[model samples]
Each structure stands twice: as structure tokens, then as C-alpha cells.
Target chain A: MVENHPSQASKFKCEVKNLNFYYGSVRVLKDINLSVFSHQVTALIGPSGCGKTTLLRCFNRMHDLYPGNRYTGEIELDKINILAPWIDPIEVRMRIGMVFQKPNPFPKSIYENVAYGLRVRGQSQRSAIDETVEQALRNAALWDEVKDRLYDLAFNLSGGQQQRLCIARALATNPEMILFDEPTSALDPIATASIEELITQLKEKVTILIVTHSMQQAARISDRTAFMYLGEIIEFDRTQTIFSDPTHRKTQDYVNGRFG
Target chain B: MTIDNLHQLHRLIARNRFWEKIFIVFGILSLLVGIITLLALLIDMTIDGLPRLSWQFFTSFPSRKYEEAGILSAWVGTCLVILVTAIAAIPIGIASGIYLEEYAKKNWLGDIIEINVTNLAGIPSIIYGLLALGLFVEQLKLGRSILTAGLTLSLLVLPIVIVTTREAIRAIPNSIREAACALGASKWQTIWDHILPYSIGSILTGIIIGLARAVGETAPLITIGALTFIAFLPDSPFKSEFPYISFNWLQAEFTVMPIQMFNWVSRPDPEFQSNAAAAGVVLVFMTLAMNAIAIFIRYRLRRRIKW
Candidate 1:
């Protein structure tokens, strides 16, 4: 059993209490209880089919797109219950952005791709959108490479550039929190290193919850780490302790690469 | 080399080469058959009608005398009827397809609608003509006019339009829709901003092909009682007065190129036969032009959007 520390609770940006999720009566998340701190990076690390990505999706209700998926439990973002029936998924999504595993850029020009989020959210001024688009690209470390050819089609860029373009697109919306579901898994090692650098810098401004398969990536960038196994969190602690001296055997075994 | 080994190798090479030559000849003959038939018909039509095609043939009204008859009113009515058909069909067809692919729930009702659409596409064009004749002309009292003919042809091609639109929408990857939704876009916004834009090129190709089919239709218009001979053009859609637009010609009498050609071919006069061949050539050219435009636009858009 993990002890709850009361002093650290109030600083949380999001809290999941007794969360249970189901896909057509088959339980996928078993009584998940966790909290993510504000302006910090928390990484969720687990093997395949352990429900890490599933739990990440619950933050923004990405599973609502399909039928027969249900969630029962309290999920609070800044003291508001995001799982309440009255809350709109679209509204929740605007407050919290998500980057998918694959780099799915819109079939449009790079400028339009970054501007799409702002444009759909009702930002119509040309000058304002232009400034925000530039800022986002710069923040994602892609402005210098693509600034000259913003009007070109997004697919014309290489894979790494496209992924960074997606990041820029998410950042343009100015969300308080961003979710990363293995954002670098599809990228090469060089691209992955650049994205890790970007993520470390991003935590200064926004809260982040990243799901990753690489244990080293979690140890490298995250301020906190949660080791999940078979739909449950086995350990949650400071990244240093989780890597060096975890309280749970499962965490120690998995971290040392004995087995996934 | 041993005598037996040389003999076996020579027989094997000779047998394979002989079969390869046979297959090559067959493939060339199959391709040539279609090209030869088309070329023969084109040459025959040119020889019979090239001299008859002139500015007067394009501008003069149909006359009782074979020498004086032209297809001016027929071609004009063809344009007017096609315009009406496009206006009525494209929106409804595209909307139905979108609703089925994006909005409709996957249940028995949806299944029935889908199955029925496929079945409707396979039904004969003459059946749709009879349906339109009964519904639009007789029951709705639209009268045997341009509007009635347009409505009938729209029905004839509606199935084709719906089927093709659905195919185009299906070709889009689901990831694009999910990406749009993840960006905080609502259902309407996702469809309008992402789904519609990416699939629009394909939808347009389908619509143009459908419209081409509509233009070539003869039975539906005939069933709806379109006139065989029309000497006067319909009124202009533009007005010099207040409102500045008019649809007064929709309810007026009309005749199209195919009907005019049919009437000419049924005549006993050799000159009228030549006129019929000329009209057929023009109709074929129009269909080919529309198809060429569709192919060009589809190619351009496919290159632009790699996804």
C-alpha cells in the first residue's frame, strides 16, 4: 500500500480518485488513484496492454469517440470534475491538449496546420494568428527549419519535422496541460533527443503527463514517475527514488530490465 | 556437352518461348479490338457528317427541310436541363453520403439505407424514368417541360452520385478525423474542416461523372415527355430589371441533343442520317471533355495532398 501525503495534494493540477474505466463491461482500469502536480512533468511507464495509454486518454476523454466505452470515478482538473455528464468533451479538450503516438498532421500547408487549432477555437484575426503560429513553431524548435516555407504542404517535410509541426499545432491553442502518448516512439533517436529537450523546457510553463515505453526516457526528463502494471499503479514517487530506490519489487525489476 | 543434356535444355527453352509468344499475341489482339472498333466508327462518322457541321448548324433552329435543320435549340436546352440537374442533384447526393458515412448510427435502419442505395445503383435507368414520370410529371403536376426533364435525369443519376460520394468518403483515413476532434473541434467543425476538405476532390470527381451520365441520358427525358422538336431557346436567366435573375425558363418547353439525334435517325432521309451522326459526334465529344476535366482535377489534388 502506498501512503498518501496530504501536503502535496493541493498543488496537483489533476487528480484521479477511485477511477474505474470499462470497454464494454470488460474493466481496463482498476481503481486508479493518482495526482499530477502543476508545472511539472510526470511520466507513466508500463509495458504493452498495461493500461498506461488508456489512463492517459481519460484525462481528455479521447475514448468518447467510440461507443460502449464507459468511465466511473472522479477525475478533477483544477477542482472541476471533467467526468461529469454536464461537462463538454470539446471544452475539456481545449483546456488540455493531446499529442498522438503517430505524427498525424492535417493535409494542409504548415501555416494552416498550426493555425487550425486557433482558427477552430474562434481566433480570426490574421495578424494575431500569424504571431501565435510563429511563436509556437519557435517553441517547438521548428521555426528556423520551416519558417521560410510556411506555405508549403506539410507532407513535404520529413517525418521529424512533421512531428514537430504537430507539437507546434498543439501549442498554438495555449492549453494549461498537454498529454503526450509516446510522442517520440515513432521518431529516430536524434529526433527523440530533440523532443526530450523540448519537453524539459516545456514543463516550466505547462503541466505535462507523458506515457512512455522507454524507462530511460522517464528517468531522464520526468520530475515524477508512476510505474503501472496490469491496469494498476504499482509505484508513484520522485523520479530519482523510483529509479534508484523504489519501494515496490515490480518497479525495481522492471527498471533494471529483468522483464517488462 | 553430352548429347542427352543438350537435347533437354533446347526443348525446355523452345517450349517456354513458344508459350510466351502466344500470350503476347493474345494480349496485343485484345487491346487492338477495342481501339479498332472505336477508330472505325469515328472515321465513318467523320466522313458522313464533317461537311454538315458548320456555324449555321450550331446557330440555326430546327427546320422541317433536312438542309435547313440545325441543333441550336436542342443544344441550348441540353445546357439548361443539365444546369438544373446539377443544382438539384449534387447537394442532396453529397449530403446523403455524408450523413451515412459520418452521422448515421450503425443499426438496422442504417443497414437498410445502405443496402438500398447499392440496390438502387444497380436498377435500370429506364425504371428511374418511369418513377420520375409518374411522380414529377403526373402527380406533382410539373408538366412536360424542362423542369420535369431535369428532375427525371437527376433521379436517374442520384444513385451513381451517392454511391461514388460514399466511396470517396470511405477512402479518407480515420486518423484525420480523430486528429480534428483532438483539436477541440465539434462534430460539425470536424466534418466541415477536415473530412470535407480532404475528400472534396474525390467527391467532385464522382459528381462530374454523375453529371456526365445525366447529360447522355435519353430514355428518362423521353419518358417524361420532353419535346422531340424545339425551335425556340428558353428565356435568359438574367434580367435587365430589379431582381436581376429569373428561372422562368425552367417551366418552358425543351429538347436535348440526344433526343434530336434520335428523331433525325428515325427519319427516311439520308441527309437526316448524316445530321444524326453529327449530333452523336458532338455528344461524344461533350462527354469526353467532362471526363477529361474530372481526371485532371483528381490528379492535381492527389498530388497536393500526399496523405
Candidate 2:
């Protein structure tokens, strides 16, 4: 833990080593190595079935939620093996909260959705839950739009508001890293732009890993970007360098919309 | 044919409003038929059995004479059987459902249990009675006591409780469980704190329906030899004298409402027939009360856990 911080040369606040994953002998992701940095947003751009989400799910161990989806490598958060058999997936998830591809607000009031994590973690007092819910929603940039009708059911919110509530739910537990699995994929363009702006603003205090298919979104919001192709990341560099002068031809071709 | 068809069209066109009025009258007549059928059943039951609906009918003991036999013992026996049966069935049935839905692995054992549970729900009630006779009465020596009858009834309703409970548990989405687990809650905590509460409304609805089915069962109680005109009040679920009870579960016999109705219906006396209908009315009211309790709990739980 002591060796994790204060290393300028270290590109990753969290790192994956020799990562490989399989779903019942059908390989979904092949050897992957990447380092996510603190205080910066890193975007992963790849077409569908390119294993972008599979690799992002590695961080929070969401794949383990399903039996028979096996991994054979190490995902380290502060030098601890995340994929270790003894590591508690629930604890890992709390540390690395996820915003799913779809806006899945719980079938509950918006206020409870925001306060869900705290309440589930055994915090029962109204004042603390209320305070945390307010703070999390504020952090997700959704408090103003929903403060008046927090007690109203979450389904009453429009698509964009629901997406923000999902983000707020993830933020409620004060996670160290936030993994977004194509969070804007289901939203309209206006909502997508708003989410992109929120991600940019969020990088100062959180390590953000966004798996997106949009090359423009990667260039606009990410400090660094990784291009994954066929279960392997082909390139990783500073966002502009990878977009403008990518060393790998496949990365260059894909970014230029030549082919998937 | 041409002249008749043209004349009919002319009449229909001239009396369109009259045809609409005729159709409306027929529609209302069909609805009234349904209401009248139910009303007739109630009124017939009331007219035949209302004379026996007195304090003596409840308090007096059975007699060899036509006018002397009271439902006191059979009533308490039936109540004892039903209460014990529900106590035995609800927890076991509900817990089994939760286990199958949440914890069971996708394997041959789970598949077999699921299939067996559905088939159990379809078995004839008399078959359950025989099984109870062979197992509870003969092998265990529970005798023709109320406990034996209660056990038989519990088995009768177990499958239904399980099936309904499985449906209720399935109605809850996986997202709620995931959300709870993601909050660093234990497996048990997630179930107790989220899954169970989320499913309580539906589970209670299923149990009430199951209890209604339990209360109406007659053949099984008869197989266990429900006392036809028992008149002594049950001592308790604990007492061992005439109202057999024991602190240890080794000694307890009980009675229930359906058993009393069966006892009254089986006698040859005219008074006993009226008494049977009277007991039927009470049984109907009890089942109705259970159904209402279920609906009330479902509505209350829904309001409390709208999430």
C-alpha cells in the first residue's frame, strides 16, 4: 500500500497484468495490460464484441457475479489482487462502483436510489442518509433537477435524469474508482453530451474508466485512450497522441473509421 | 329469399336504436345470471342452516339422539387441526421456495425437485390421506388423533405454498439483489434485507390462497378419522387429557374446521345435515377471512415497500 502512491513514472493508479478471461472455454478477452491513472479520465474505444466492457468489468469483478465466466490473470488495486479467489467481490465493488450501459434506476423513489448504498451498509439514521444522498446527487450533477421531487418514483424521471441517478447511485458509496460501461450508449445525443461533460468534470477527484465506442467522445473527454481490437488492447497513449499520431496502424485505421 | 332478405335489411335499418337497446338488455341479463347464481347459493345455505346457527350449537356436546349432538368438540378439533397445519406448512413451504429460487444451483437435483413439487400439487387429496395413514398413523403411532389429521392437511397444501411462493420470489428482479450485494452486504443480508421484504406481499398472497385450499380439504381429514360429533372442547395444543396436549411434541392431537364439517355431513340424521351446512357456512367465512387478511397484508406491504 505504501508503494502505491507518489510514483510519477507510474502510469497506472490501478493495473492489470497478463489478463485473460473466458466464458466456459470461449475466450472473451485475451492477454491485456493497462494502467489507469488517478486524477485523469481514460477512455477505451472499440467496436461491439471487442471485449471493452469485459475488460472494464474486470476492475469491479462484475464478471464473477455469473458462474462459469472465468479469468486467469491479476487485476491490482493498490497492489492487492482484485481477482484473487479470497478477495470479496462485494468489497471490490464498493471500492470500484460501476455505471452500467443502461440507466437502471431501482424501482424505488429517487431519494432511496441515491441513498441505497449507505442504507444497505447499515446506516439507518435519517439525517446521515439524507446528507449522503444529497452529496452524492450533487457530485453527479443531479441534485438540482431532482431535489423537489426526490420522494417521487424514479421511473417518473426522463431518460437523462435516470442516467444521472444511476451515476449518483454509484457515487453514493464514495468509491475510489468509477467504471462506466458504455454509460451513454442508451441515451439521446443531448443526454450523451451532458454525460460526457459530467465525466470531464468528475476526473479531478476520481479515476474514471469509460468504455465507449465513440472515437469523438474518446478524444473529447479522455486524457488517455486505449484502442481494443478482438479481445486485446492494441494501443494506449496520451489521448491526442493516440488520436493524431498513433504508432500502431490498426489503431490509426480504426480511429479514422476505416473498418472495425 | 331476395324479398325476405331485403325486407329484413329495411327493418334493421329502420330500428337501429331498437337493436342497440335489445343488445344492451341481453348483456345486462348475462351479468345478472352470474350474480343470481351466487346469491342463490348464499340464500339456500342461509335458509337451511340459519336455524342451527345458535349458541347451543357452538357450546353443547355430541349426543346419540338427533337433537342433542353439538359441534363443540368437532369445531375445536377442526380449529386445532387447521391452526397446527398452517403452523407446520407455512415456514417449511415458504423456506423451501426461497431456497429453490435463490440458492439452488442449476443442476439435476434442482430440476428434479421443481418437477416433483409441481406434480405433488396435482396429486389427489385422498392419496395424501392414505400416505398420512401409512406414515403418521401406522408407522409413527399417532393414532386417529387431530395431530395426524393436521399433518395430512399440511402435506396437502405444501406443494401449493411452494409453487406460489416460487412465483412470488421470481417476481423480484435480480437488480435488487445485485444492488444490495454491491453495497457490501452478505448473501444472507441481501436476502433478508432486500429479497424477502420485496417478496413478502406476493408470498402472503400465495399463503392465503394456500390456506383457503387447506381449510376446504375434507377427504384427508376423514381418512384420519375426524370425530363425527365430538363435543368436548380441546384442552389445548398442549393438553393431553380429552384435549390431548403435551409439552413435548411426542404427544399432541388436534382438530380443525373442515374435519367438523365432514363429521356433520356424514351422519344420517336430518338435524346433522343442517348442522353440516352450518359448519360449511363457518368454514366459508373462515376462508373468506383468510383471503381478506391476505389482501390486506398485500396492500399494506405494497404501500410500505413500493420500491
Candidate 3:
């Protein structure tokens, strides 16, 4: 394990060390190192194109969708090297679920959308699938709104409900960590508040690494905040210290809105 | 000076709007011209063939007597040929399309395949007929039978099926694929469970349109030596005995509607000309029916999946 500072605990759900990433010939992330504490919300606050999304995608190897994207160094989840050559990307994804910025539910029924991950994990029993689907929807705070219309097409739901359904889909697999990529940026103020509440509740069950553009959101929900600029983390500290009195000049300027 | 400049800009905008209106008129004229030609042809076919459109004209087999001749054998042959073409082309075309769109990497091999498929789609149907004649008829020794004609038609339409299937698969958003992948679904499972279901309507539309084109094609079937005059039916697929379905039907000689119409149109008799026009009408109706079914299904699917 990497050495932790005396003030921080040593219990990390996942750890990244000397991580470097490139898309074709252009380096996007350079020599990144960070640790996600267990069952806590760690928010990555950065400007656009600062490699926050790239880092989240790297956690599940979502960059494998296309060719010419490369990664180096190590990302260990619970002491197991997730980036090891022998590890299957599909298996890694099951352990680390992701909710995208835009809510994308399949064009299937609401019940099918929640049950999809379970079905993919090879759960075939109808009774078990039904029970798990209900549990996931309840956890996502969507069961009461959608229980009567479980068979309706997912697109029939409102924007917030659809986002919640996407969360339910991600929750169905019961991953160790769930990554949220600007999950509330597309939502309205009310919807954003509800989703923020959901995130805080969710942190009790799974480690969350949320990338947000909103500094207020970071202050409100994140236990720890990492301020990133260019392609590097400028400061990693408690949310209170990062907001009230940062250690770095860059973090202080960013917190005071001097510049991105 | 500022007012003069604003006046000049207004004049330029007015001139552009005038030209746009002229182009719109030209486009409407061009569309009307095409639609008018089609309408004229349909009217002529109705006039020539409506009298011959009776129960007997559909039920009776072809004969030396023009009055006694019907499209039973030819229509049945067309249906059989289409069945074979669909069976041979649908799976192969959809699979190749999926591979090219979803699985294949952006490398030299993939580029070569894409370019070759585009080139294949441009080649004439008669060229495909010659290739099938050389390969299936002579080299494979399938002879000029029903199987040979069906296989030839399948080759003629394969490029269309593949091209349209690829287009349909490409229309699917990448988000759906990524969502499936993130849920721990394997590549094959993601494609089978999500991709195929979402795009099945378009794929079937492509297949039907391709089959419709194959049904109307004459040169390929004629070039492959399908008979124009056949009195007896092919062996029956069903029987009263055990193992009831028979494969012997495939080996029998067959005649399609186009070839039969071509034979009649080439004859000197006026009655034969009427018979040819009637057969043309039947072919047109069949093509229309297939297209209608495809359109209906595509419309329903579009409604069902709004996203």
C-alpha cells in the first residue's frame, strides 16, 4: 500500500499510482496518483477537458471502446490490480458501475431496464429478477413513481425519473464502487438536490468518485475534494480545508474564482 | 453611409430569397415530372391488364393457348425463389454487417472490406448472374434448376441486403452499446440482446426491399438458363408419408414471372402481348405488396422505440 499522510486514514477502497493515459499520440493524463477512501464521496472538481472523465473511464476501462487509447501504471481495487493484464474488462465493469452525465436508459420497459444488469450477470429466475428489480428501483427512489407502470417504455419517464432509473440499473449489479460523471449537471435545481441527496445516501453502501463542475456541490456533498487543473490534481484535501483555506496557490485562486 | 450599407445588405438578402424560391420551384417540377411518369405507366398497365385479371388467370398453369394460360407456375416460382434468397441472404448479410459496423477495428483490413462492399453494390445484376452460372451451375454442378435460379437471385441481392443492414446498425446510438457493456454484458450478449432487438425492424425492411428487387429481376434468371415454359409443378414439399418434407423440389426446373413475361413480350401475337402486360401488372402488385409490408413494419418500430 502507498503511504498515507498521518492525518488521513489508511483504508482505501481503490488506489491509483503514477497513472498515465494517452489518446493516440496526445497525452491526456500524466503521472496521476490518488486514493479513494472506503464508503466516502470523493469529488473530482475540474474545468472542462481536465481529464476527470478520462480518469473515471479508466477505472472501468471504458476507453477500450475504441482503438489507440493507452494506459500505464496501476489501479488497484481492494488490493487487487484492476489494470493487470489477466483481469477481464467485463469483470472489472461489474465491480465498478458507472452513471453517465446524460441519463441513457434502454428503449425497453422500466422493469427490464433495472433487471438488465442482473440478467447480464446470468440471473434467470423470474421471481429473483422481479425481487431484485424492485429492490434496485426502491434504492434509486424510483419504485413508488414507477411501480404501477413497470412495463411502460423507459422513455416515457420524466428526465429525473429516467436518471433515477439509470441509477437503479447501475445499482442492480451491486458493484463495490459506483462512478458518477457529473450526474446532476443536466438536471434542474430541484432534481439536482434530490440526486445530491441520493448520492449522500448511496455513499454509505459504495465508494463514489464523482466528477463535478459545481464547486458548491463539492462543498455540500463531498467528504474530500481534489481540485484539478490542466491534467493534474492541484490539491487533494478535506472539503472544508479545500474550500475555506487551500494549501496551493492554484487551489486558492480557483476557490476564489480568479480563473479556471 | 451607414444607411446606404444597410440598404445594400437588404437588397442582397432579397436577391438571395428570390433565388431560393426559384430553386424550390425547380425542385418541385423535377419531383412532379418523376411522379407523372410513374402514374402514366400504372394507368397504362391497368388499362391493358385489368380485363385479364380473373380467378383463372391466377390459378391455371401456362399453355400454348394464350386464353388458357395463367401465372400459377410463374408466381409460385417467384415466391419459391424469394424464399431461397431470403434464407440464404438474411443471416449472412446481417452477420457481415454487424461485424463490419460493431466488431471490426479501424484498420487496413476493415477499410479494404468496406471499399469492396461499396464496389460490389455498384456492379450490375447480370454480372452476378454470370458469376453464379460459372460457379454454381458448372463448377458446383447444380444445373439450371430451381436451386440454381434461387441461388443466382440471392447473389444478385446480397450486396443490397448487406449495405442496408449496415446502415441500420450504424443508426443505433453508441450510448446503448456502452450502457450494455458497462452492465457487464459480454460483447456477443450485448449485440444479441440489445443491438439486434433495436435494429431488427430496419434489417427486415432491407431484406424485403432486396427480395422485392430480386423478384422483379429477369436478366439474371434468364442468363442462368431458367426455363420460360414449364407445365408441371415441382415436387411437393409436403406428403402423406413420414419425413413428410421433401428436398427433391429444389432440383426441379422453374419459371419466374419476369422470364415468362419476357417470353410472351417477344412473341409476335397480340394476345401474347396482352398476356405479357397482365404478367407485368402481377409483378408490379407483388413488388408493391412487399414494399407496403416493409413500410408498415418500419413505421410501427419507429413508433415503438421513440428514442
Name the best candidate (by lDDT). Answer: 1
Taking the true A–B contacts (Cα pairs closer than 8 Å), what share appears in each candidate? 0.74, 0.41, 0.85
TM-score of 1: 0.93
Sort by lDDT, best first.
1, 3, 2
lDDT of 1 by residue, B1-307 (tens): 9999999999999999999999999999999999999999998987888888989889988888877889999899998898888888888998999889888988899999999998987787788779988999889999888898888888777777888888888888877877788889998999888888888888889888888988888888888788898889888889999899998899899999999999999999788999988888888888889999999989988777766
Q: Which stretches of model 1 miss by more than 4 angstroms?
A: A1-9, B1-24
Model 2: chain A TM-score against the true structure: 0.95
Q: What tens digits encode model 3's per-residue C-alpha lDDT throughout A84-188?
A: 878999989999999999889999999999999998988999999999999899999999999999999999998888999999999988998999999998889
Please state the error at residue B35 of candidate 3 in Å.
Answer: 2.3
Docking class of 1: medium
Per-residue lDDT tens digits for candidate 2, residues B1-307, read: 6999999998988798787889999999999999999989878887877888888877767666646656676566666677678889999998999899888897899999999999999999999999998999999998877678777889988998999889987877776766666666667777786678778888878887887887788787677665554545644445546546453332344445666666667778778888777767777787889899999988988864533
Across A1-260, the per-residue lDDT of candidate 2 in tens digits comes to 11344654454679889999999999988889998887688899988899998899888887777778998889888888889999988889878888888777776789988887887677899998899999889988899999999999898888888889988898888888889888898999999999999998877667899999889989999988999999999999889999999999999899999997
Error of 1 at B150 (Å): 1.3
| Model 2 spans > 4 angstroms off | A1-10, A108-111, A119-130, A145-156, A247-253, A257-260, B1-47, B54-76, B134-147, B236-254, B299-307
- Residue range B114-186, candidate 3, lDDT tens digits: 9998888778889988998899899999988888888888877778888888898788888898899989998
Once superposed on the true structure, which residue ranges of model 3 sit more than 4 Å away at CA? A1-10, B1-29
In candidate 3, the residue pairs with backbone N, CA or C atoms under 3 Å apart (3 or more residues apart, or in different chains) clash, namely none
TM-score of model number 3, chain B: 0.92
